[model samples]
Target: MGAEVITVSTDTQFVHLAWHRDEKMLEKVRYPMGADPTGDVSMLFGVYDENTGLDLRGTFIINPQGTILNSEVNFYNMGRNIDELMRKFKANLHLSKHENEGCPAKWKEEGDKTLKPSPDLVGRVYEALQ
Candidate 1:
């Protein structure tokens, strides 16, 4: 779980402060909240909506080597699932350590059995899963 999380918004710094202070929406947030009123970051991430002057929900997981491991974009109304994100993160970490293995659906932890890609696995995934 050695990861850094930062959130970027099109709102100004004052707006972010107000939301954190008055609205108390982000009062408990411990990570940095970057204000990108100019939409530079949003544009870079391709989440900015030019017409609406807003950003869609975008989540990116970048590895330590500056490589993007996962990228997901959703409509403004759609919320993200942190648990699923954590699962994917763990799987990525596991794969980085075990390059010969593959994580299957519902693989959650370090000790979870991973799939070994092979011709024998073809047409027998259900049996392999069991």
Candidate 2:
């Protein structure tokens, strides 16, 4: 997901953020990341809070194609497992390479086992793991 760029914000519409109380101050910001309010982008990923109208804390694993692969929308005060998300994203990439193989829980690229839905060579995987 890092290979691709990721952006998280709290504005649902550009206009909503554009009408900030400090219009002049916010206008000075160059990037949307700096000015987008109401969190439309955040809502797209189900992280924006409707009540408070702010970007909820979230972690989204977006693919290079601009598609969301995984998401974790929790809270700004709470913490997320960035390392684990990276591992999962890598494992998903690995499985995609071999579309026929199915990755199990906690799968990784190198030594993890992948099932092909048939008995071709299960023992071989065990040996590889060792």
Candidate 3:
């Protein structure tokens, strides 16, 4: 994946610095941790919680063209899965080159079978996967 990763939160920049300095899990982190104290960036992404004055956990995969390829928002306690994100990233990349094709739920990598949407595919997806 040749994509840039940036994590944004409502915390201040100093808080991000402190986390990077002391958090064991982020010891080797190289990506930027954005501080959105005013929640403006989070609001733009529709992840801001007005009642809580915080941001919900959100992950967005935006392409170079500024179009969001994938968006996922979860509660504060719920975390995300890297495997599924990777799958979506791969699917988007594959679909960009094959606009007429559709990646099924089981599609994981290149060369995996894809569906060609049509009236004939209405109830034949199970057969197509086989």
Candidate 4:
């Protein structure tokens, strides 16, 4: 929960301001809407499209040490799932403390079952989930 969120795009600050002012979806967003018209930030993240002059939808969760814990990239028209994003963020946080466990795709919360990766866990994930 101690993470900062900044949504970056190729749009200018004025464009972000107008969208926040006029769009119902962005009206409640209080985080910084970063303007990357030159695509520097997007290029750094490997989401910039040189042909279209736009960035694909990308989400990244970075730890305090500046390591990227998770990255998800999608096409521009594809909307992202906040629930899944939250799940991945929570799993990353949990994994930071419980270094021996791996969160499966279905892992949703702290109390959810996690797996200990070993040779024995290779072919028995289905049984372990049960």
**lDDT of model 1 at position 90:** 93
- Model 1, poorest ten-residue lDDT window? 18-27
lDDT of 1 by residue, 1-130 (tens): 7889999989888887778788666667888889988899999999999988889999998999999888999999999998999999899999999999989988998998789999999998778888
Better of 2 and 3 by lDDT: 3
TM-score of each: 0.90, 0.60, 0.95, 0.98
Tens-digit lDDT track of model 3 for 33-93:
9999999999999999999989999999898899999999999999899899999999999
Clashes of each: 0, 9, 0, 0
Residue by residue across 1-130, what tens digits does model 2's lDDT show?
3364335465444644556545775565443343346566566677777888877677776666777777777776876675787777887687657778776665766567766645655556554434
Which has the greatest lDDT? 4
> Candidate 1: what lDDT?
0.89
| Residue 76 shift from truth in candidate 1, angstroms | 0.4
Each model's lDDT comes to 0.89, 0.64, 0.94, 0.96
lDDT of 4 at 19: 89
Name the better of 1 and 2 by TM-score. Answer: 1
In candidate 3 the C-alpha lDDT for residue 5 amounts to: 89
